[model samples]
Target: MAQHAAVDDLVKLLTKANYDLTLVQHRLDKEFQQIYPHNANPLKLVSRIKKIQEDLSSLKEECRELLAAKQDLIDKARTTLVGNRSLLKRMQASSGLPLISDSDDLAYTNLNQIINEWTVQVRPKTGDGKHDSDSEDINQLLFSAIVQNS
Candidate 1:
């Protein structure tokens, strides 16, 4: 029960972190959109975009850390529950109690399924510009603009 509670708490944390990341990405998208329409100060705009990219990179690192922590918690909970179930089965068998066969196995399967679903849902978006091809064009525009200005 305690392990279940711990896992629940970690899931909540992971959800919150994912939400925070979404907000950050949305902000970055908005900022990126505004950068292209402006005809003023290409150097300044490039500098600003570079800073935003740096911040986005940092946020991604944080998301990765949170994901890793959530994975660790799930692993620990799985290990502890499996160990407890094994011990209980031994105790029950020694006491001539009727064995409940494969109950732990079912629980473990369900837990793994749930964790896999959450992992797929909560995985952070990669920061590589390939995800948004427009970003590549924008980078080229910025480069050309800077070169022309210089």
Candidate 2:
């Protein structure tokens, strides 16, 4: 679950790297110039410096991609959570139950338990003459659900 640096963290890192690269660039130029007067062997080290720069560029791009993916996941999760809450509210209304508070409790709540509670509220009492049709309809729905699941 460990993620790469956040936007501000990356900014801070880039700031430090920029300063360090400035110093390193100046020193490398001075040293390379001093060495070049004696021989041409330092060209191999130039490739090494360029390699470091290329690696740094690749790393920055990777960090940016990771951050965007993390943000996209967060956006998707927020949308799903909001839709679930709306559905829960509608279920409460239909069941004639008091609405659960929109709070942290929802995170801990068992979805199955809430569904069972709603069914209990809506189900007709046993042996009640007035609700026989409603009871039959509920039974049919339950049977259909079981068949579908199978």
**All candidates' lDDT scores?**
0.66, 0.61
Candidate 2 stretches greater than 4 Å from native:
1-46, 104-150
What is the Å distance of residue 146 in model 1 from its true position?
32
| lDDT, residue 99, candidate 1 | 79
Task: Choose the strongest candidate by TM-score.
Answer: 1
TM-score of every candidate relative to the true structure: 0.44, 0.39
Worst 10 residues of 2 by lDDT: 124-133
lDDT of 1 at 69: 63
Where model 1 places Cα greater than 4 Å from the true spot, the runs are 1-44, 103-106, 115-150
What's the distance in Å from true for residue 12, model 2? 54
**Candidate 1 per-residue lDDT over residues 1-150, each given as its tens digit:** 999999999999999999999999788767766875664445567788999999977965675555556656766887898798889889999999987767556786787788666444333333343323233333334334434455
Model 1's C-alpha root-mean-square deviation from the true structure amounts to 26.0
lDDT of 2 at 82: 66
lDDT of 2 by residue, 41-113 (tens): 3765778789999997786567555544544554465568768888988999999999877554556255435
Cα RMSD, each candidate: 26.0, 24.1
lDDT at residue 10 of model 2 (Cα atoms): 83
Residue 120 lDDT (model 1): 40
